[model samples]
Target: MTGTFKKIRRRVWLILNILVVFWMLAGVLCMQVPPSEFWPAGFVALSLPGALVLNFLFLLYWVFRRSWLLVLPLAALLLGWNYYGRLLAINFAEEVPKEAKTLQVLSFNTHVFNAYDKIVEGVPQVSNDMVDWVATHPADVFCLQEFYSRVNSIEYNNFNRIGTRYGKYKFVSTLETDRIKANLGIVIFSKYPILQGGTIHFLNKQRESANRAAWADLDVNGDTVRIYAVHLQSMSIKSEDIENTYSAIGNEESFKKEGRNVARRLKRGFIARAQQVEQLLEHVRQSPYPAIVCGDFNDIPFSYTYQELAEELENAFVKAGNGVGATYNGPLPFLRIDNQFYSPGLRAVSFETHYEMGLSDHFPISATYVLEPKAAE
Candidate 1:
């Protein structure tokens, strides 16, 4: 009986080892591309775990076995290469800033009117808190997603109160939806003179949900700097999804339903986001000046949108930010979705994620960039 038990244990371990190996290979090879492609779909279909899970398992395996050989290779397969890439990007930013002109940009998703209702009831101080946050940051250029304001509001004067609070800044406000109750949209503010700026309405909504991308041309030392502020399709998994996910931990029916909903949302979100990213890619390709793309992407760092944007520009956070660099304003923030991506000629001098202000569901991200000089135009 003892011999039979030993054989059973050996068989179990062997099967588990094979499964782990297959999992690592699948994640590393075919599905390693940006989440905006076929790979993300494949991952979701397989019901494979996220990077966070794999990371945790990798560390736990080492803890139990005390073996560097197996653990180190797993780490490399999981997240090592991306981390190294981020390091190299930071090194590149550090060296380039010393020799060029600088531009500071801020990106934030105010979460539909400063997340006031989400956090508390009758929070009149929310607007003031937002103004104060911006004043403290003092960015050369600011891009705001979910920048809610009064309906039928026109011109930069509409935001005069907030503008005065931020040292009389100029801005271009786009109407995502013209409703007094919601009053939600995007606004781009600049201390630098705005040569030209406008809205790129992606989804014309009767109900007003999917509003994305704002464009601007700022005069940077007599050169044109194109800026694209974007907010992509959300993960679709809502508050109920979170509740169901937690409740399902012990309850079987709840668990099955929650799992199915999560899988459905993940697949749908990936496909829609990939389409949106492809459009943005086309926009970037057509841009006629040095570009800076900044906003609350709403997706994690590993998603397709982030990687696609990075192809044409350098991510400011990965370039200069340190630590986990999360920007979501919540009880336990574990991801960096707000980002600033700039042209290769631009260099990031300083980058920071402002987390102290409690006005929005997302914290603001700011970065100072240096524009390289040229002999010609």
Candidate 2:
């Protein structure tokens, strides 16, 4: 009986080990394949960090047992090593040299300035808090996503307040779905002069408020740095859908319906983001000056969208951030969805994720870049 129990346990471990390794490998390889080609790859990449944790546990178990199966998890990790920094980093913060040419850019999604949520007493109205914080921030350039404003009233004068509060600033914006003399959109404010700027109109906009990219070419002294502030396709998964992820007993049918609904949204987001990123990348390719891309990507670090961007530019967090550097604040935690990607010519001297500002569903991230001045042209 003891021998039979040992055999059953061994088989279970073996099966689990094999499954974990497969999932991890799938996530590693999926970054190169677009979800438009294989949609399931996006879902697989979503659980990659958790899958990595499980694989580590299995590795330890195998090592303690003096089993050769330790090779499974070990091989999977080595193969996925390229993505290690994207998911986790332990580098110390970098220091900006005094008098060095530096450009500070802050990117955030303000959740429409907490307009629809109840304002809690004494807990800091996130909308007011974010607005005030941004106004006083020292960043030379600000790229805001899901930016809200009331054009005709002083009630929601975020644009005028932030622009004037800081200093002399120029603005470029892409406002959509205006109603009641207000608008929801993306914008960029810069203390430096903007040489040129405009919006990248997405081909598909009606499905779930697919956002557009706002670009501004700012003249930092004599160098022109193009900044692209983008908010990609959202998964459209609501709070209730997250709550009903697992149906109650005797409501299996309802649960299944919700499951299908969530899956459909997820698949749609994956494909749409792939299409959007391709379009955004083409714009980057046409950029005559060095580019800085930042905003709420709405996709994970291991997705096709990030991979494509990383191939063209360096991720600021991976270059300078410490630990997980998670920016999303929501029920599903530990998601590093927001990012700052920049051209290789620029160095990320400092990177910070302002997780303490619990004002929005996503935390604000700022990065300071140092670049060599161009020769007198």
lDDT of 1 by residue, 1-377 (tens): 99999678756654565565565455444334545447354353233334335544655765676655455436545554663344223333355535467788888887654444533443222365675566566678878787765433332123554555565445555654422333456777777677777665554222333657878888876877888888877766666677768878988987988898887787766666666766777887887888888887766655555656766678888778776677876543466778888875677777887877656778888888877775585
Candidate 2 lDDT, tens digit per residue, 270-315? 9889888998999999998889999999898888999999998999
C-alpha TM-scores of all predictions: 0.78, 0.89
lDDT of 2: 0.83
Clash-forming residue pairs, model 1 = 36-304, 101-370, 101-371, 103-369
Each candidate's number of clashing pairs is 4, 0
lDDT of each: 0.65, 0.83
Angstrom error of the Cα, residue 67, model 2: value is 3.8
Off by over 4 Å in 1: 1-21, 28-68, 71-80, 83-99, 115-126, 151-158, 164-173, 176-183, 203-209, 375-377
Those runs of model 2 whose alpha carbons end farther than 4 Å from true positions after fitting are 1-12, 118-126, 176-179, 205-210, 246-250, 373-377
